[model samples]
Target: MGLSKRNRWRTLVTASVVFSLVVMATGIALANITLWMHANPTFVSGTEKLISNFEKENPQIKVELVVFPYPDLAKKVLTGILTGDVPDVYQGWGMWFIPYIRTGKVSPVPSWVTTAEELEEKFQPSSLGAYYYKGKYYGISAETNFWRGGLHVNLDILEQAGLTIPETWAEIISSGKKLTKRDSDGYIIRAGLTWINQDNSNSQFLAGIMQNGGNYWDEQGYVKLNTPEAVKSLSFYRDLVLKHEITSLTIDMSAEVHEVYFKRLAAMLIRPGWVVSIIKAQYPDLRSAFVALPSIGPEPPYYPAETGWGYQVPAAASHKEEAWKFVKFATLDKGASRAWLTEAFLLPALKSLEDDPELLEAEKLVKVAFSQLKYGRYVGDMGSRERFTQIIFNISQEVFTQKTVVKDAVAKMEKEINEMLKEYR
Candidate 1:
């Protein structure tokens, strides 16, 4: 009886092992059937075309696209990434990539698949830096943007006032006094320029400081918010508001804030390329134009601290090879430039695209912004530089609000920075 029971037990154990393998394989198959993606909720100009084109070629891959408003997307994407329920591929900030690098979840771009030399031969050196880590590539390169935020001057209004776009900070201050208009009722009948704030729609402060030869952080990456130079830049901006372009104590935070730009009531604004859309929409009858921002206490040959907004891949993607295949088909090789030049307005990061007669021959106006990508900046890959951006914002708020003067702001910023640096150091 004992010998017969042993044989029966062995048979049952063998059956259990076979059942487990079947279950595991079945689970993987179910997971592969589902692919997910998300974008900022409302489909805007460039993003809409990208999604449509990516889907057209990748029809076999079922992508479940989710859209959240900008605020909701930021919160949800952050939470979702940490919890490990991340999408196979997603759109995320290029600056915040360092944290994701630590989790060992991100897939490195395979060296054998595409050599670095080959990539460099094709694309601009800077855009590739966004997706690179410690000299090795991580995320797939999508597109590039410029950091040329400047006071998009309303030349129409300036001309009406018999003034020209000011070349220097002193000119800006003087021109504002001449151009500013008001009524006896204390309402701005027609303002010389608009005072910019630290609002969501605009983060022109960083670029403004840069334009004035002021550096955001030292080489070691400590916040030097109170540098004599940065302070001078901010002081000029402050004066522009308090002395001229003075509006109500409360800012007009509406879709129409941009409408103010087109009506030519406001003379100058530190805005981006997309501001032209507002001009076309609201002030169709008026002519709008853009120019380089004024320079001051900052360095010469001005550069706006550029922040790249592009596409990235999550480490959680099970089929990285296939995912990369899709990315390459959409964002790399001839595919990347061809899609952008033909369907979307994005200047291709690849150098080869510059030679593309289609891109070269396309419209004339697009070329101006497209060529500017060559001078754009890329945030460093070192430590959590993004966490450092908050340090900047905090010190900036204090300085702007007059809670702390320039010198104190820099010292306070350095102290706070060293505290944060201890972990990395």
Candidate 2:
């Protein structure tokens, strides 16, 4: 009986060893997916939940999320790609990733995406088109932003001045003059209207150019910054600072223009809808309203500058299949997308979710913004988008600082832009 008991104990020990080995093997087989995205409270929380749900369904896969500040994200991604330490999936601005796509470093959608048309059908045309290059897609849009300029008014200031919301450009200028206040020393106590010169100069210029029926590129892809329409647009913008003196040239670059408005230093600011959330969060007691900026030249074909961010997989990623699975879950899955919309307050790329309950509720607060999207123009698809925007900003700065006349500035801008384009040609 003692010999029998010894044999039984040995059998139990062997079984325990076998079970532990199987558990270890399973752990080794599980794919670890790493994703890099801009760090935001909503994004971090929503993505954490997504990973939890995904892992539950996919027992053989584990996901790791990495977050970085918005400004630092591009540099980090470039470094990762060069060092072969890139994430399985990365979220980036469309313009920044376009160059990578050209270099064949960003992978096209998986083989499952058989055709461009199939992919296009899944997203808004303009949003998806941002990631399209040379008849191929390198990324998928998760959120689309229609960043049209809108007049953000301080209701308290307007009420104090007994002024109504401006309906036209003339009215805007007139109201600006009325609302501007100065001390006896000629120092501006409050600016009537302000534009975020440092951050949004390019977007403001582009919107004005498009509204005046100007094209940034010709049929042959030549820069047209010196066209008559462009001159009118730049001159109008310049006059807002120098000629009309509606705003002050002495700006606090450290703070965003919206922050200036929130501090009650500015009565009006022309910016995108994102400011609504910023105001609601930081200055909840401040009364603010957003109205669509009136079209510059009234005829037809008015357009507004648009920009967005999306997800792309690097070609060098070791787990493309697993990466694609996560991408689809984050962007295309209904529950995941809803969570993002509710948490992040971003516009949905998927057409079906346009009327989603969460989006519907959010839309009520940004009615003007929703209306503006119809006129939105995607700026990312343009070749050399980053270079073009920088040149535009430089030209605007020259005009604002009184360094160059609008005519001369446009001419210099056109020349510089063409020089950049020659490389692509």
Candidate 3:
């Protein structure tokens, strides 16, 4: 009977151990969270390190990163929402989030993740633009993205041309004339200023208008692109090709403008802070400096800007609490936030980190970009920013080709964009 009692006790102990193992396995299984982001080389490496650290801290949790190509990410998330198969967490663009918010696919960040007051206190009000919608906050601000403000100067080229950095619109034009190099056949061997690339032209154009005291959006919050300011903006860019003869549309139309700048075919390219990483990583020998764009108008320059990228939880998220833990860790935690900004070459969205000595020392260009934040103009009310951008590009092409006049080009842009806005409105 004693032997029998001993065997029974052993069996009970074994069962208890098995049950504990099962419970632990279940906890881990439920803790798995998926994060989605665009596949940007700059953002990926840092994200991997953060994920590893996050998993270590929360042993019960695991994170799987889902990367889509940069251009395809917006569509992928929108489709995922329709299918109710979105990731637990994802990186969101400021203007792109409007559709997700309208669809109710993204959740308002719960108080547990971050209180509204805490968010306001920790982040610069402008940096939080992307995550806020009509009366609701959706995510944590991760980066401050200034789309087209920094004028990246090739120092070697400028010094060779015997000119300093351009400080005003007139100076830029004059410098362009002096710096442009043409071959025997009158083909431009090197460009003075390269600004009309597909990726950035719209923002630059809009900045031109805003700088000239034009409003892209009317008082009623609809797109208003056909103003005199817009016409002047387009005319100036066109003259850069036809009148000034500094840069050619053919070269810019065929290749990436950044590549043109990198190859030394273009002396200056309008870029954002992130290019500091690309330059340091790819072209270490290239002598470069980033400065605020030369004043574009009689008034102070206006920069068309937006929230760069941030983290958000989907309303359809399965592991919300776990997801928020990762979000809070990645964004609000000082070490992780600093690591991300440093690795990704992004500007700080947090006020505290804006002047952090270590960060400033690491990324000196960030200070120049940060100083221009006062002139940042956000068009948060656009019905469809993607469509708006496409229209601007189309108008640019038409105006440059002389297929349409500047006034006609902007008018066409205005009409097409307003039509697209109807659906969102």
Scored by lDDT, the top model is 3
Write the number of the candidate with greater lDDT, choosing between 1 and 3: 3
The TM-scores, one per candidate, come to: 0.72, 0.86, 0.89
Candidate 1 segments whose C-alpha is farther than 4 A from its true place: 1-45, 55-59, 163-175, 183-191, 195-221, 224-226, 243-249, 252-265, 277-286, 297-299, 304-307, 333-348, 353-367, 381-387, 421-425
Q: 304-349, model 3: which lDDT tens digit per residue?
A: 7677688878889999899999999988888788888887678777
Name the best candidate (by TM-score).
3
Cα lDDT for residue 249, candidate 1 = 23
Model 2: lDDT equals: 0.75
Q: Which parts of model 3 have CA positions greater than 4 angstroms off?
A: 1-30
lDDT of 3: 0.80
lDDT by residue for model 1 (112-221), tens: 55667777776666566656666776665555545445456767677888888787767776776777677797666555656444331113445556656666666775
Q: Higher lDDT: candidate 1 or 2?
A: 2
What would the per-residue lDDT of candidate 2 be over residues 4-57, giving only the tens digit for each residue? 888899989999887667655665335898988887666677678877877766
Task: Give the Cα lDDT of each candidate.
Answer: 0.55, 0.75, 0.80
Name the better of 1 and 2 by TM-score: 2
How does model 3 score by TM-score? 0.89
Worst 10 residues of 3 by lDDT: 22-31
